[model samples]
Target: MASRKPSTDDTTHKLKEDLHHLTQTIEDLVSATADDSRSNIKELRARAEKRLKETRDRLESRGERLYDEARDSVTHQVDACDRYVHDNPWTSVGLGAAAGIVIGMLIGRR
Candidate 1:
C-alpha cells in the first residue's frame, strides 16, 4: 500500500467541510432552542437593567454628596485665605504682586 501524503489544499478543504458541518449543527440547535434562549435573555436583561438603574441612582446621589463636600472645602479654604490676607495686608500685597509679576513673565514667554 502506498502511503498518502497530506497536502495543504487537502487540509484546508477538510477544515472547511468540518466547519460547514458544525455550522449546520449549531443552526439546528439554535432554531430548536431559540424561544427558551430568548426567554432567559429577557429575564437576565430585566434584572441587569434594574440593577444598573439602582447603581446609577446611588452613584448620582454619591456624586451630589461629594460635590457638596468639595464646595464646603473650597469655601472654607477661601475664607481662611481671606482672613490671612486681611490680617497681614501689606505682606499679602507684596506677595501677590510678586506672584503676579512671575505669572506675567511666564505668560509673556509663552
Candidate 2:
C-alpha cells in the first residue's frame, strides 16, 4: 500500500480558521473591556495573554507535527523504492535507463 501525502490546502485552511477564531476572540475581549472596572480590566488582560499564548503553542505544535509527518512520509517512500530496487535490480536499471532516455529526448526537443 502507498502512503498518501498531506494536503497543503487543508493545512492552509486550518491555519486560516485558527487565525479567524483568534481574531474574533481578541475583538470580543476588547469590546468586553468597555464596561469593566480597573481590576476587571487587569483580569481581562491576563486572560487575553493566556489565550494568545495557548493559541501560539497550539499553532507551533501543529506546524512541528506536520513537518515531522512530511519528513517521515518522504523517508518511507525512499525506503520502499530502495527495497524494490534491491529485489529487482535489473528491472530497476532498465526502468532508470528508459526514463533517462525519455528525459533526454524531451530535453533535446526543447
Candidate 3:
C-alpha cells in the first residue's frame, strides 16, 4: 500500500475551487431565502454555523499555542525585573519611570 501526499499547488487550486463553490452556495442560499425556500435557507445556515465553529476552534488552539511559546520568555523577564526592583527599589523605580516616559515620547512623535 502507498500513501499519497498533497502538494502546495494542488492545495492552492483546491482552495480557489472551494472558495468559488462556497460563494455560489451562499448566493444560492440567499436567493432561496428571498424566494421563500426554507430548505435551502436551513441548509446554508447549518453550513455557515459549522464553518464558524471550526474557525473558532482553530483560532483558540493557535492562540493557546502562541501563548505557550511566549510564556517562558515573558515569565523569565518579569522575574528578572522583580529581582532587580527588590534589590534596588528606588533605582528600579526611577529607571522604569524614565524608560516609560522616553517610550511614551517616542510613540507620541510617531
Candidate 4:
C-alpha cells in the first residue's frame, strides 16, 4: 500500500495539538516546581525544554513543507494554464479579450 501525504487541514490540526501539548508540559513543569520543594526541578526543566525544542523543530519542518507544497501547487497550475493556452490559442485570446471588456465596462461605470 502507498502512503498518503497529509492534507493541509491534517497538518494544521497536528500542529495545534503539538502546541497544546507543549503548553501543557510547560504548565505542568511550573506547577510541579511551585508545589513541591523536594521535587526534581532539574528533570522537569529538562523535559520541558526537550519538548519545546522538538515542537519548534516540527513547526519549522512543517512550515517548510507547507511552503514547498504551495509553490508546487502554483507551479502545477501555471503549467496547466500554459499548456491550455498553447493548445487553444484562439480560445484563450478570446476569453482574455472578453474578460478585459467586462472589467473595462465595470470600471467605466465607477
Candidate 5:
C-alpha cells in the first residue's frame, strides 16, 4: 500500500488550525500579569511570530510557483495557437467567421 499525498485544501486547513491555536495561546498569555509570566509570554510571542513568518514564506513561495506555472501554460497555449493560425490562415479565418455567425444569430434571436 502507498501513502496518499495531502491536497492543497488539507494543507490550507492545517495552516488555519495552527494559526487559530497560536492566536488562542497568545490570548491566554495576555491574561497573565506576573513578572515571570511576562518573560514566558515574550518568549512564546517570539516563537509564535517566527512560526507565522515561516508559514507566510511557505505560502508565498507556493503562490509564486503556481503563478509561474499558470503563466507558462498560457504562454505555451498561445504560442501553439499563433503557430496554427499562421500556418493555416484561411482555416482560422473560416472558423472565426462561422463562430461569429453563430454568435450573431443567437444574439439576434434574444
Candidate 6:
C-alpha cells in the first residue's frame, strides 16, 4: 500500500490549530499572573504577548504565500497535462488505460 503524503490544506489546518493552542496557552498564562506584582513577571508576560502577536502575523503571511505557491504549482501541472493530452490524444488514452489496468489489478490483489 502507498502511504499518502500530507496535503497543503492539512498542513495549514495543523498550523492553525497549533497557533490557536499557543495563543490560548499564552493568554491563560498572562491572565493567571494578572494578580502578580512582580516586575519580572510583568515584563515576561508583555514579551510573551508581543512574541505571540508577531508569530501569528508571520504564520498568516507565510500561509498566504504557501497557498499561492501551491495554487500556481497545481495550475502549471494541470496546464501541462492538458497540453500533453491535446498534443497526443492516443498516447494519453493508452496511458490512462494502462493506469486503470494497474489499479484494477492492485484492487483485485486485495
Best candidate per TM-score, number?
4
**lDDT for each candidate structure:** 0.70, 0.84, 0.74, 0.91, 0.80, 0.81
Model 5, range 23-68, lDDT digits (tens) per residue? 7666756655344677887877776677778767877876786788
Q: What is the lDDT for 85 in model 3?
A: 87
How do the residues 1-110 of candidate 6 rate in per-residue lDDT, one tens digit apiece? 99886687977797787677677767766775866768756766776677677777877877787888899999999999999999999999999999999999999999
lDDT of 4 at 77: 100
Local lDDT at 66 for model 3: 61
State the TM-score for model 3. 0.44
Q: Could you give candidate 1's per-residue lDDT for residues 4-105 as a string of tens digits?
A: 854658656855665565555555555645666877656555555565565556557656766887899999999999999989999999999999999999
Error of 3 at 66 (Å): 1.1
Model 2 TM-score on a 0 to 1 scale: 0.71
Task: Please report the candidate that would top lDDT against the real structure.
Answer: 4
Error of 3 at 79 (Å): 7.3
Candidate 5 residue runs with Cα over 4 Å from true position = 1-36
Cα lDDT of candidate 3 equals 0.74
Query: For model 1, what is the error of residue 53's alpha carbon versus the real structure, in angstroms, after optimal superposition?
Result: 0.9
The reply for model 2, stretches above 4 Å from the true place, is: 1-21, 32-37
TM-score of each: 0.58, 0.71, 0.44, 0.84, 0.71, 0.60
Local lDDT at 10 for model 6: 79
